[model samples]
Target: MAERSFHVARLPGFATMAVAVFVALYLPIFTLVAYSFNASNSMAVWGGFSLDWYAKAWANEQVKDATVRSLVIACFAAVISTAVATMAALGTTRRRAFKGQTFIYVMINQPLMVPEIVTAVALMILFGLVKTVTGIHGLGYLVLAHAAFCVPFAYLPIRARLEGMDLTLETAAADLYATPWATFRRVTLPLLAPGMVAGAMLAFVISLDDVVITEFVKSGGQDTLPTYMLGQLRRQLTPEINAVSTMLLAVTVVLLTTFFLLTRKKD
Candidate 1:
């Protein structure tokens, strides 16, 4: 006789609760996206659909400048943080029976353990002092601060990838008289490329979307997109801001989806 399969029914209350949670989470996002197409400047009152705000946002010179600066900071910080994290992950994972290994790991991840506001305040104080002495003012400070903040985000994925990696291939390479550099370059690197790419993307998104650290660390006129958006919201309310927000939302969703797909479990 064939085995019988039983289907389980989902509870009505559970389904209703799940729908309520989704609505609470996504209703605002849907509203924001809808208003991005609003013809009128008012956020609350919709005056039919139009693409005028998007065109205006594109034409804004400050928006262009802020976006370029943001991308520049994100790119440099992502590269620096990802490189540092890859090294840190390798050091912690490849070594055995080391003293204070756990402590070292925790130290590397301190940025994540501490609140962003605290880190921003501390960085603001430190950078202010450095600026007073060095007379430096520009994107350099923002890049450094972002790199420090993004290190832990980049570290986790790389470390997980290293941990999940099979050692049989590496051991075989050693048995075949491959040098450490050769083994790493030929065997390990090829296998670990996906994780490194994922880490770099993660770092880039984190740095790009950061407002607290960027706002705190930036000098006068050095507004990234988030900071610029905040300034716009503070001074005036307009659909142009909504247009820009929509673009940022789209970019973030695409990058985060890619990150999610890359980090998903594979058999």
Candidate 2:
């Protein structure tokens, strides 16, 4: 009875703590989403409900250009990262643990573990040197930075799937006198498709949201959407920014929904 009463006494505190956590995490998001619809220019005071800001933001040439640039960068990064990650997963899973395996893993995931500023500083210095030597003022530097950073995000799911997959199917294909490439293409590739798609999506989202590395690696006059948003924020706060944010949120939701629908189990 004493133990039961003690447990009952703690329940309210646990409930309070959970409520606090939920409020802390979601209250700001709720506010931002709500204010997106405010008719007034001031975020602090709501004048009315209006969609004019959305129209203005959509019509902005600079916003359109930034959005297109961001999409192109994300697509390229996703493709490159997914391809390299798939190859790395196959090699790592097929081979026995080696002296360099851990090192390679660390290097691949360094972008995630290291501070953003550190990566930005290193990339800036490296690119500056490359620019001095090569004189190529291209956005390829940004593409490389995004792809390199996205690799670990693409690597993890593919590696997990490869590790968990049964090897018997590949063995049977080999026993049937199939070439190694044929075996992989017919058996392994089909099995790995879902994980590869998931990893690619992950890489794409990471590249899309990235700002720090982009700021460092991007040449002058080549700003992605996030960088453009940052610039706008620095100058002034406007409902147009909020409208842009809402559109970005909608795009993300649509992409994630599409990914889910594509990956869902079929009867």
Candidate 3:
């Protein structure tokens, strides 16, 4: 009975801790979202509610351009990174271990192990050389940089799915004279789709929010949404920033909710 009372006494502490954690994580988000409708420019005063900030954010040419650039970069990064990482996952997990296989795996996943700033600096130096050699300046450099960062993110879950998969069915298919390409196309690919989708979404989010590499590799006039937000911060804190932040938060919420629903285990 004494021990039971002690446990009961601790329950409130645990509950309080959990609530504290949730509040700590979400209170800032809630404040940002709430401030999006603030009539006043200053965040301190409520100044009643208004949607003018949303309108202003929408009408802002710089915001529109940056948002579009971010979307394009994320889309390209997601598709290309997913494709390459899926292939790498399949090859690494499905094949028998051979000489230098470990090295290949390490090399493929080096981006995750290295610091982002280091990667950004390396890409800056490399692309500088390329630009000097070819004289072409475009968004391709940003796309490639983002893709390099996203590869390890995409590789992890796909490789796990591949490794956890049962090989007996694949062996049976082989025994029945199924071609390697056909067996993979019909069986392995279908099973691996969930992991691939999850990884791609992760890559998209990473690319969307990346400011460091984008700041480093991007040339003049190519501001992504995050970089645009940084630029705005330098000028002043306005409801416009809040409104844009709210939109980004909504997008993140939608993506995560959709991903959860899509990837949830079916009955």
Candidate 4:
């Protein structure tokens, strides 16, 4: 007979814990989402239901500028991070394990292990030196910084997909005397494309939502949406900020949904 089912006995406890956890996590989000529709500027008490704050957020020039800048930075960061991650994943997975393989993997994922504030401070100091030497300014640094930070987020899924792939097709391709480029082009690349796309989307979202690194590295007048929202918060609390957050939340949900759909197809 199977082992005695202690799990069943703990089921009610687990259920209660799960409910408590979900409420703790999502109640604040649900509250914010609800207040986004509130007509009054106050978040605590709902005056009524209205879309005025969203309209105001849409019409704000600062919001528009920050949104566009964020999109541009996210696009560049995602493309760069995804490409770098894909190459790293291939290097790590498509060959036999070598000496220092674990070290290399750890190095690639360092940003994730390192504290964000530590990373941010380090980048800030490094970029300060780079700026002194290069005299370059504006979005370039932000994009590069974002890409560096987002690389691990992109790398994880791509590496996982590559690792999960059956070697049979790849081995057959090799046996067919196909050149490396042609074999990858014909077989590995096609299979890996969805993972790459998923990684890119994840990287894009990470870049878009980043605020700490952005705050540390961004030059004057380079405020991203998150930074802008922070600035607004510092000055005054407004329901407009909630509306902006809701819009960002909407964008994030859409990207995550698309990522899930793509990964589901892969599965």
Candidate that scores best on TM-score: 4
- At residue 129, give the lDDT of candidate 1: 98
- The digit string of per-residue lDDT tens for model 1 on 75-116 reads 999999999999999999886759998899899999999999
Error of 3 at 214 (Å): 0.4
Please give the RMSD to the true structure for each candidate, in Å. 2.8, 3.3, 3.0, 1.7
Worst 10 residues of 3 by lDDT: 3-12
Model 2, position 147: C-alpha lDDT score: 92
Sorted on TM-score, best first, the list reads 4, 1, 2, 3
Off by over 4 Å in 3: 1-12, 98-103, 262-267
How far out, in Å, is residue 164 in model 3?
Answer: 2.8
* Candidate 4 global CA lDDT score: 0.92
Quantify all predictions' global Cα lDDT against the true fold: 0.92, 0.87, 0.89, 0.92
Q: Of the pair 3 and 4, which is ahead by lDDT?
A: 4
lDDT of model 4 at position 149: 90
User: Which candidate number maximizes lDDT?
Assistant: 4
Which tens-of-lDDT digit does each residue in 1-267 have in candidate 3? 776565753765888888899999999999999999999988889999999999999999999999999999999999899999999998888878889998999999998888989989999999999999999999999999999899998888778778878998798888889899889988889988998988788788889989999999999999999999998899888989999989987887787676666556676
The lowest-lDDT stretch of 10 consecutive residues in candidate 2 is: 258-267
Clashing pairs in 4: none
What TM-score goes with each of the models? 0.94, 0.91, 0.90, 0.95
> Which pairs clash in the backbone of model 3?
none
